[model samples]
Target: MNLPEFATTRTLNNCPAPAKLNLFLHVTGRRPDGYHLLQTVFQLVDFSDLLHFEVRADGQVRRTTEIPGVPQESDLIVRAARLLQNAIHDRTGAAAPGADIAIEKNLPMGGGLGGGSSDAATTLMALNHLWQGGLSREELMVLGLQLGADVPFFLFGRNAFAEGIGESLQKLDTPGLWFVIIQPGVTIPTALIFSSSELTRSTKPVKMTDFSIASKKLFGKNDLEPVAARQFPEVADAIKWLGKHGDARMTGSGACVFCGFTQEEQADEVLKLVPNRWKAWKAKAMQEHPLAGLLDR
Candidate 1:
């Protein structure tokens, strides 16, 4: 397989595309364009899906597996690669050979872990190097944002404070703390959350420092939680269970619930106490994205 001079010299071939958790999500309003306005902090976690690339002669981007519920063509990874190719071709007068991208899915789908967006970000970043496009990281991030609001943050690839549909990003120096993530096995359609009449449409913006400290209270509930809990009782049950461990809160929209703690041991203690019926994991928050370490080299 052909690779960049730097990548060719390295032994490791795979890139780590990490997942994100919305430390807390607030639906502030809806735009006239039908997009939801949001304010939330995107926290990168050690948990991730592995993406392996093999350069191909043909310029066709494809995924190994159909992402369970998402259509192949509509998948973010494909769209992102196509977007990058278009952007680079338009600006640089050339395009890179498309690679067959394979993803080892570990993160749960529809759980709001940003798996799809992360995968898309990996596609753009990896191809930018693997194809030898020589695009600046900032330039790639700009192209990524057009793929999805979450895409830019994943491209930034770190702990970030985000607002305005989650495209706006501000990097933060959050310590590597531990988290307990619970998935209740129910898929809460994102559209349902946004379309719900009960969804909050107005929330005053809070300062970053003030927001970080206030997040400890978990007082500002996820606006979509109520509609989700009504549709899926198991989600509420998972939240109730994790709440016993710490200040349990829902991530984007619904379904997955998380609680942050100071130590892995404490998170493990809570993990053991959880009922065997629900799926859960204990992961440390990442100061930098797992993929950043790969790219930096």
Candidate 2:
């Protein structure tokens, strides 16, 4: 029999990569590099994708399993391992470290919840330890950034208030509220939304101190929502339905919509009211990533 997760999830060979919700996403501006500058808050959720790593002695990074549509070379997990391997080789001239990575995915792709970025982050953290790379969080984060903008924040390992293309992070004291995240069973194309002429590129920047302790709960809004909603009716439907229970917003450039509740029972009640056609899950916010201390914070 397979041992339950909380009981055995942190074993030597298996590691957890938690999912995240963008409590709010603001497109502050666009960089000359063609990347969009963003101001957002990243909240860790209990929902996660678990990775099981088997180290390869001969220095070959590989994935033992397949993610239905993603090819092996293109998987973020694979890319992360290779990126670290190359960086470690350059840094210390040590034996190139490698692993056969396997995934237990729970987070949905294109749901705007940072599944791919978290997977890549976990690969860097896990392989860094298993292969004895000995790189600090500082080193790992640089390699993480090459994988994706969001990768570095997962390596930051906290609920953060982010800015500057999502890398500049300041830890936030946000509440760990219960979340009712409803997946509208649609895959949102982030690129499509970003390129649309309808997207508002300017949302006045807010100081972190602008919100009082009591007002923090009311401050989240996704600037991408209206654009996404216009393209995907399912997204609009989810936002409208979830908003009935609590203030709801799209997480990231989302196809998934979520609302917060102070009580688990309150979230559970709203979760029950979700239309049967949609997929949904109840999760609690995580103050820190599960693999947080694998490397120094």
Candidate 3:
């Protein structure tokens, strides 16, 4: 994969949009607007989806690839490109160039991995560079948030401790760990989990300092996990199976569960033992996104 040279590159190929694990999610409270206040660490992993981009002189953003069950208009990648195009035009009064975007998706939909959001973030970054939009990372982050709460974290380009419905981000250094993630063969709707009356929304918020101390032992927990596990037996069964090896927990909402290992060998050993019935893989924790350099600092 060639690194994108902002000034000269008309096409950015094999751009990576990595998946994330919510190290721990705590729903601290609910706003009057009905958005849940959340505290969680967004850990980027080596697992990712690849995207290809080619600049178009004609001002029309189009997704050339078809994703089953996802309409092109509704795809975050397309929406993100259009959003940036409109923003650029509105700011400069110049007809912004567009892009033909193709995605090589590896991440599962609704698996609690932030796949779609990450893809949207990658599109924003790639096109901003390709189009010379001159938007700062902070500016791009603002645009990303309009697509989804999780999008800004990817554009933020580092492993982050996130709050305020997962948008307010503070950088945090985490262990160089390996993770074995299991996909439970079902897609979990995040709204379903959040709307459940059984879900608890009153986990006391903890300070960054507390997490710094407790991270060594992987302290804190996902308050949404129990509700998801009870509603989706596949999630419950996966957590139960992986727990025998270590402390296994669901990542975001449901349908995927993970356990951390200090060593790659340990993660590999556990990965080999995962049940064939479940889809599982191992990945190393990433310090920053692969496309972090594309943004102007």
TM-scores for every predicted model? 0.91, 0.94, 0.97
- Per-residue lDDT tens digits for candidate 3, residues 1-297, read 334444447888888899999999999999999999999999999999999999999988899999999999999999999999989988899988988999888999999999999999999999998898999899999999999999999999999999999989999999898999999999999999999999899999899889999877676999999999998999999999999989899999877899999999999999999989999999899999999988854
Better of 1 and 3 by lDDT: 3
- Residue 278, model 1: Cα distance from true site in angstroms: 1.0
Candidate 2: count the clashes.
Answer: 0
Query: For candidate 1, lDDT tens digit of each residue in 95-133?
Result: 657777777788887888887788888888887767766
lDDT of candidates 1 onward, in order: 0.77, 0.85, 0.92
Q: State the RMSD for candidate 3.
A: 1.5
Rank order (by TM-score, best first): 3, 2, 1
Candidate topping TM-score = 3
Q: Kindly report which residue stretches of model 1 are placed more than 4 angstroms away from their true locations once superposed.
A: 1-12, 214-219, 293-297
Better of 2 and 3 by lDDT: 3
Error at 24, model 3, angstroms: 0.4
